[model samples]
Target: MTLYLCLPLLAVLLQPALCLNCSSQFERTPDNSDLIVDCGTSVITLQINLCTAHWAGFNSSDLALNGNHNNSKCKGSIDTSVDPPVIHYQLPVNDSQDNPCRQSLQIVDEAPDPSGPFSAFSSIQSVIITGYIDTPRSDQGVISYSTDLYYHFSCRYPLEYLINNTEIVASSVSVATSENNGTFIDTLMMRVFNGSDYGYGLSVPPTGLELRTRIYVEVKAVNLTGNFNVLLDHCFGTPSPYNMSQSEQHNFFTGCSTDQRTTVTSNGLSKVARFDFEAFRFVQHRDQAKSSIYLHCILRLCEPTKCQELLSACNSRRKRSLTPFGEESNESATVSVGPLYTAREDTPSAAAYSNNMAPESAEDDVTGLVVGVVFGTAAAVALVLGGWFALKKYYRV
Candidate 1:
């Protein structure tokens, strides 16, 4: 075939590999300007600033949102009035039939564990945006050229809004059970703290908590939308995790605290509802036995617009009801955390206990523990007696 004919065929075969030569990553100028991605309520905006010194021929057509070559929802333009140029893009946040360009949303949640940091967060929702750039097509024979590699970049954002509420709850915790029988809520977590931070004081097994110590707790709404904030309606603590071994103490009733320390950080003003109380042992706790403390909360997500008024009027003598998430029905869900043992007087301090204890040994039975202690004592006594006998025999008086 003629050289001209071959060139045409080669270009057709390499059509899939158009090289946009986009930067390897976000490029920052000496003055500090770089790629900026802004997430908004209904639309997302992205701006890419490139210095003419390094990117002389860069244009707005080199990058595609989600790699959609024919996407109608995304639009872009290039600005060259200044020494460097800026490429701008705007796309809808939501995906629909009219505009097929789609962004992804993800929800992350895990069951709370005994670990200090792990037990505190129950759930989180995040939105992720992605895009890809075109690069040079590979060719050989008579033609030779260098090319940049294709790249896909992503950015993540939490689906939460800015709230102005920052009240600290002052209520203390006591033994209690669930007053409402509603089903359990998903993605809500309960976190415990002994002092300023999450003290390693909460034990596995064979360990115990210091009695009468203050405990701070935070409860967060995970799967709910960003428009709603969690509010504590009622809460109680007990020695048992699920069953009622004894009468429980009341922390909050109808959004009002029974004690000053037993505060609900806000009256449905924030997504994370916080409160605190002191740790105590069961009056009838047995000796040398494994034990735990469980906390139960009856709460719901409420819109900020209606939460303050609804919770404030709780002090009035009129009949009161709560409609969680601005719904007509009185919907609420229960969240609980437990198997938390108070540190025994003989146990290590909270920080050491958290770092040293094995989670598996917590389930060991008391009988097994007692047997091990006895065996160790017997071995020590036998060693002492044997040493005395050997010394007396060696003297041979």
Candidate 2:
């Protein structure tokens, strides 16, 4: 009697389950797989290892195109019975949308396939389907992001690696500015310390310092296609649109070239563009001035052959051994070696030299000249008078 009483209650609960089964539960089999790119057919089909072309969703009765999902329940499933289980689809492929940048495959349930046996499938549609194609790697790939290079410098040698012809490197850099009592002053100080003896193929420890008054420009570039060299073509400054005159372009920021690569040091790395102006030299030309700076660079991916050639050159340079100064042995040679000579002072003793006299006065010089002239004039007068007297006596005789 208890079992019979419970059966009524169980029937009530099971009623909803029966209705769910009776309703067609539409399902697309072999879900979530890559589509084989097909452009020939507009019909939707199914295959073991491909996406379905037509609506494979479930419906109790063949339903017309209506957006209502209450009519049927759709479930997604993956069938793995075949060698490469895939639900194939014959949806028309759009060649225009066949790129990594575009959305090639879109499965929509708003419309039905226009053709064939499952034409009544109003709940599913393949809007766009395209075959898989490998995308080309970006030539100028960004491994790390940084704006610190703008303000602070870092080491450039001992690069981590090269990607797309770009040398993945780090640098130690710094920037500082001081005002000379409201006067504009810019200075760049650079230094470098290498952990290894060989730095860019040099035995001497790498270290440098540079002080410039002009604004420094550091240029950096990467080839996007990996086909050309990265060249710093040009750099210019645009005046702060607001304060054009107050912010005159510094002289140092003139035409910069690709060859003007910066030499790195502790304070900062070499900038691609540097101004010719010094802190002290007075700027005469104020006609051409801009406040903001802009640099244009060109990038070309490097050729594999060129990279190999450069590597070979570097290897050869590193392999060349240092020549030894004439070989020396521990045993002394019979030939006599000259004694080291020390230079002696050749200057005379202070006692032997006369002391320098004070400079004579102009008045004293004038007085001496006057006295000599007066004596000379008086003697001449006396001689003239005596000669005249003798001539007169001789004439009388």
Candidate 3:
């Protein structure tokens, strides 16, 4: 019995020594005074407590087991927790006035961190712009403003006028978006046309007026992971004036004519012209952004006739007339009848002639006396009148 028991113990210790076809090797290590076995392979190494259980057969089925074992294989996998890109934008802090002539305006933007500041989880792929032009009450005529995100990075758009009350001078768009160095820029322009032209037989000059331009900027950030975010900013241009040229001035004034009753004709009427009154410029400082200029335009109207009339009236009052029919007479004279004349008889020189002959002779003497007195008086008055009487007599003759 003693020999058999010793044989079994020896066999137990020698089992690990058997020559297996497997090329892998098993090594033993001591941990806390306990010996552990490490099985090594090309793909993985597994640790086991030699005292717990003996090695079983290396069946292919064991490789399929999902549980932990002394000898296990390792597989590779990919990490998908990558961080996204970032985006940012800068613009003028102040609002801008309206512009009628400019079809486009530039809007500046700044980005310190192309990977963050605005969006940390994505890259900025494009920017969208939208808004309307404000028609200020101070504006002399209607103005039309338009915007295009594709052509202009700034909110600058064209401006125009409306034919009817329902016509819109403002417009919006989502046309195109641009990506530049992880930063986005946009532009817009405005237009203003003449609405009314009054006729005064002279050319009308362009009328200047004040208007407001409003714009909103939105950014789209798309990341490598296909994620995105949108940020918005409200900016404005300064109030600008619509300018007019000499030719435009002519078209404005003579383009329309008024009837005797002061009725105006509309067929030859033309649109109004506008000009920018304020200057617009972008201001940049170290990392911050701000608007340095205001959007605005001056207003003017065609009024050559009015100016000429004013000048003529002023000159007419300055110099006095030298002719006899002077300004005073021309202003005060009236058409009427001339002075009247009456006939008179002298005292009957009666008694001298007694009967018919005496009466007749008396009548003749009386007439002659009256005529002499009248002639004498006339001669005295004529002498006093002098040249004036002579001229009057010549004209009468």
Candidate 4:
């Protein structure tokens, strides 16, 4: 009976350490810990960095007029009825790490094991105040000198699940040569068109087509020190201006190849993965007559551990598997995307053409003389007629 009574007391003590609203792997301190509010002339910058665990997912929608309805995700009110109108705003734990305004938190390592020489886990479970900051006022102050400020404490967990760890880079991209194999050859063939031009005495048929280039996208994945698969969700080469309808921007691709996406698997323990993207067609931009291919790709990084857990949970529910890509597979996906790099061809400058002018031929000289003589005679006649008309008009007047 004494042990049972103590158990209730122990549970009550630990309850305060629990995260607010959302479930997390670590114990969470109150959001008020290490909180500092700096109210500037135009903006309110709230800094909260001292929590053992933190929740950084508060969104802009929570500040709506009726946004705190029922005091669910967030709570607060504005008292316009009072002098200077006290605005009571409470932060909520409704946002996720993938939120655009959310800041990135780095994982901290705990103390080393006393009994063993090795350290603890790769990362520690802690509350980090690395996430979005609420800028209440962008152009003017929301809190007046007499306005009262009453905010609440809010936090949540599973810090590693945030979108802060993924990174993608495009190391190199070039026109795919013949050695890349048959598919490239086929793609090149489709883009090439047979045309005729006789620059000299010789008549030769030339293959004229926009160059079909391939992009190499590298992703700096996280926790993927093991076997995993990388999926290229979408890739499109966008011109600098989206509204550009030039031939190079629009006519390169046979169709929207990005719509038919594919996946690739990295077989061993690798932290860096490479993806070859060839869905986009390359055409010369009008600016310099050099083709600029701005490639953007959305990549999904998947591993086995999280994939299995999500799969099991979805299966137990007897519902259709809600995979990362909404497929039946157990791939916990994190998105990394970018306009990796632009591929452009070299073109000669206008100065080069001007400097390489050819000497004038006798035929050209004769054409120039005839044109000048005709213009000179017409100008002289027009001047004489103008003088006669002026004199006639003056006499009549």
Question: How does each model score on TM-score?
Answer: 0.37, 0.19, 0.13, 0.25
Model 3 TM-score, all chains together: 0.13
Candidate 2 structure quality by residue, lDDT tens digits, 283-338: 33233221112121111112334334433644475321211111221110111111
Q: Rank the candidates by lDDT, best first.
A: 1, 4, 2, 3
The per-prediction tally of clashing pairs is 22, 42, 81, 7
Question: Superposing every Cα of model 4 onto the true structure, what RMSD results?
Answer: 26.2
Model 3: residues with Cα > 4 Å off, grouped in runs: 1-216, 224-228, 231-397
Model 4 error, position 355 (Å): 21
For TM-score, candidate 1 versus 3, the one ahead is 1
Q: Candidate 2: global Cα-lDDT?
A: 0.26
Model 3 whole-model lDDT (C-alpha atoms): 0.24
Candidate 1 lDDT over residue span 313-343, tens digit each: 6657443432111111112222333455665
* Candidate 4 lDDT by residue in tens digits, 84-182: 222243322223443223333333334423222112213212222232323233335655432212233222122121111121132222222221101
When 2 and 3 are scored with lDDT, the better candidate is 2
Superposed by TM-score, candidate 1 places the C-alpha of residue 333 at a distance from the truth, in angstroms, of 6.0
lDDT by residue (1-397, candidate 3, tens digit) is: 9999999899886664352222223222213322111211101112222221113222121221112123222111111221111111112211233221112222223221332222221211222222211111223447633211110122321111001111012221112223221211112122222232221111112221112222111111112111111111111222111111111111111112211222122111112221211211222211222222222211111123432443354347532111111111111111111111111222356743464487677889999999999999999888888978888999999
On lDDT, the leading prediction is: 1
